[model samples]
Target: MPKAKETVLEIDLKALEHNYHFLKSKLKPNTKFLAVVKAFAYGSDSATVAKKLQDLDVDYFAVAYVNEGVVLRDSGITKPILVLHPQPVNFKTLIERCLEPSLYNAKILKEFIAVADAENQTNYPVHIKFNTGLNRLGFWESDTDYISEHLKATKAVKAISVFSHLAASEDLTEIDFTKTQIKNFTAIADDLSSKLGHTLWRHLCNTSGVLNYPEAHFDMVRCGIGLYGFGNAPEYNTELKPIATLKSVISQIHKIEPEESVGYNRAYTSNGYEKTATIPIGHADGISRQFGLEKGAVFIQGKSAPIIGNVCMDMIMVNVTGIDCTEGDEVIVFNANHTASEFASTANTISYEILTAISQRVKRTFLH
Candidate 1:
């Protein structure tokens, strides 16, 4: 893509395709690939990302809510979509949209069964989540009897899959804990299968688990960050390509004398005569305030320009001393090479937070 004339988040479809195939290479031939497109496909355009993945033939998609699934359906995403944290109020719409639900607890299970039965549905597919280690949402192994009994009593729903999340699959220091979680998930799936009188497919691996725990790559693997070109670890990141590159133009340049201040609250006072570039993105555009006062930087003409001042609601000032750049020059907030993860670290955050925090108001330019 050409250099940005204005602030834009360039979504590279080719890079996304590469990341998908790279992640797919880690799985067996039959292992299903589920792309997590929640949070607007990690703050890019969800419909565009999902549509591109759909063309690449991803086996499934997962979202956090019912309306996200509805968007996918409306975008002509026909693949099976799993609503990972569906609320009871949207259960009716969820069913109507043919989106599967992850029935994690007894309350959700009972509630969904009532709704599905009331809709006069038959053998509606549902995922049973086991709380192996990620205690966020899921049922206990001991609840298998309850789940089995509840499932047997109702023809309204059927167990399509059983899965769990890894709390720290990216951290090798937590290998033992992750292995235990995987073992627990396996055992729970087994007990649930026996009680349900049938064996259902299971998925227990997240992005890191897919790379680090091939043994636990059950029936399917769900990847979100990896699909967006982050592998959760430096080793794996080297193998994937980042898909989003945030670029903006240097709207203006100013000469600052010693003791002169920049940005809101007079946050940055110049120590020496310096040149500063004003960027159009600010906290409202997802660049955090914590990045101000020289904590973060933007690359100008291959040189690093440290952000100097309190990040404003709609702008940031970067020290551009000795740079050959001028107004209208492209400024890279984050790019595939420089990386959002690296940029986020300047603010003591993660790529997920930065990626998903990108406001929708920013224009998105897709690259094939």
Candidate 2:
């Protein structure tokens, strides 16, 4: 296909499939797969990514909010969707769209129960989130009895799964801590399931958890970053394929003499005559201003061109000095080869931050 847009995020569906199959292979034969498509599928295109995963027979989809799940539903995504952080205001809408909520606290559980009862809903599916060690959302272990009592009394909602988040599942130095979290979650989930008088799907593994802690796979495994081609670890990273490529083109070029600076605040000044190429992307396009000269770079003509000056809202200059490139030549901001992990580390951030920070205005093209 011809280039129809100047700045575009190319999503490789084949690579997504590769990532899905690769992660799924780590789970037990009976274990279910829930693909996280929140944050616009890590800034790729939630609907497109979810549709692809749906075609791959993924057991479930997860988003951070009810509106995201509604979007998937509107796009005809029939697979079960779990809203990780549902608000009381959207509880009715969540039910209307058949999206399950991860009831992390008593307030959410009570509020959702009220809504479900008011709607005359019965045996509604819900996921229970345990605090474990994340200490963010989720209920405390002591709340299990309360939750079970409420479920038994109201019968308004049923717990289909019990899950917890690992705070340091990616850190090898925190292996002991991760084990502790797993043990705590297992104990809580088992107790809750027993009180409820039925089995509950227990899952506590994120991408790193899936790779490093196979023993915690439980009845299902939730894979997020790994499905988009990052393991947060060197060994596992080598086995995955990045599915998003942020690409732009050289819109213009400038030759500046010594003492001339580029971008806002004169953040970068040339000591000698320099050749620079301006690309049509910047902070507004998810390239953080922290990636100024000497920090991050873009790939052009297979050569690295250091970013020059502060990233602007719509443009950035690169020190292209000796690069054999011209106006309109493709410049890869980040992709599989350069890797978002390497790119984001330049700004002292993680790959998740960089990937999810990509702007929606950047047109997306899917490659099958």
Q: Largest lDDT belongs to which candidate?
A: 1
TM-scores for every candidate against the unseen true structure: 0.99, 0.98
lDDT, candidate 2, 92-192, per-residue tens: 99999999999988898889999999989999999999998888998999998999999988867888999999999889999999999999998998899
Number of clashing pairs per prediction, in order: 0, 0
Which regions in candidate 2 have their CA more than 4 angstroms from the true location?
Answer: 1-5
Give the runs in model 1 whose Cα sits over 4 Å from its true position.
Answer: none
The TM-score obtained by model 1 is 0.99
Clashing pairs in 1: none
- What's the lDDT of the predicted structure labeled candidate 2? 0.92
Candidate 1 per-residue lDDT, tens place, 36-105, comes to 9999999998999999999999999999999999999999999999999999999999999999999999
Q: List per-prediction Cα lDDT, in the order shown.
A: 0.94, 0.92
